[model samples]
Target: MTKVQTAKDVIEQTKFFHRKLADFYDNLSDNVEKERVKILLEYMSRHHENLAAILDDYESEISERVLDTWFMFVNKKCDLSPFFSASINPDMTAQQVIEIAVDFDQCLLDTYEGILQNEISDEVRDVFRGLLEMEKNEKIKLAKNALKIDSM
Candidate 1:
């Protein structure tokens, strides 16, 4: 039998995803040869960490009724390997790192959009909508920062 997931469960899973991305970037930063790439990787690492923390705060502030709402459509196991397995190398330029970072954010944005498309309750929809909006804003911020890094 498939296991049902609550909104809280989804939020927790997303938090874990961000943490894993942060670790990936952190590890890459240590191995990268280019100083600029290293700096961008470190920044990406912190960005993911901050996103996870924001999720924690979001989860805490949400009503239990919304948190406990079951997502019957979200039972499939979340596979994050695609994000980790992207063609990233220590020799990648700052622009390359930024591209990867933006791609990762886009993947996350797609996930939220996918979830929001399901026929969930309004409260649950609202919760995901909020997350989706946050991700969109962060992606723009990351792109702007990438431009700044490129100019350096």
Candidate 2:
């Protein structure tokens, strides 16, 4: 049976997801030969790490009632396996890395959107809505910064 998850559970899982993405970028940065790609990977790694930290703070501030609000219908979609298993190599270009980063961000955006679709209390909904907005803004910022990096 699929596990029913609370808002806290989802937040924790997403925090872990960001940390894993950061680690993935860090590991790739170490092996890449191109300076531009390494710089982009390092930037992406820091972005994810920052995002995870923000989530950690968010989790600490949210009330237990909202955090404990369970969602029976929301399907878990935070799987990072495909990203981890993808055939990313040390020879990839900065553009290629940005594309992968965008894809990863899109996956996270979709996950939040999916969670927001289920019936939820207003407080829980507001929490997710805030998270969704943050994800959207971050994705846009990432794209813009990555483009500047690629142009250099």
- Best candidate (score: lDDT): 2
Cα error, residue 135 of model 1, in Å, equals: 0.5
- What would the per-residue lDDT of candidate 2 be over residues 39-118, giving only the tens digit for each residue? 88899999999999999999999999999998865454655554768667778899888878877887778777887787
Model 2 lDDT-worst window of ten: 73-82
lDDT of 2: 0.86
Estimate, for each residue in 1-21, the C-alpha lDDT of model 1 and write its tens digit: 244688898899889988998
Stretches of model 2 off by over 4 angstroms after superposition:
1-3, 76-82
**By TM-score, how accurate is candidate 1?**
0.87
Off by over 4 Å in 1: 1-4, 74-82
lDDT for 101 (candidate 1): 76
Number of residue pairs clashing in candidate 2, backbone atoms closer than 3 angstroms, sequence gap of 3 or more or interchain: 0
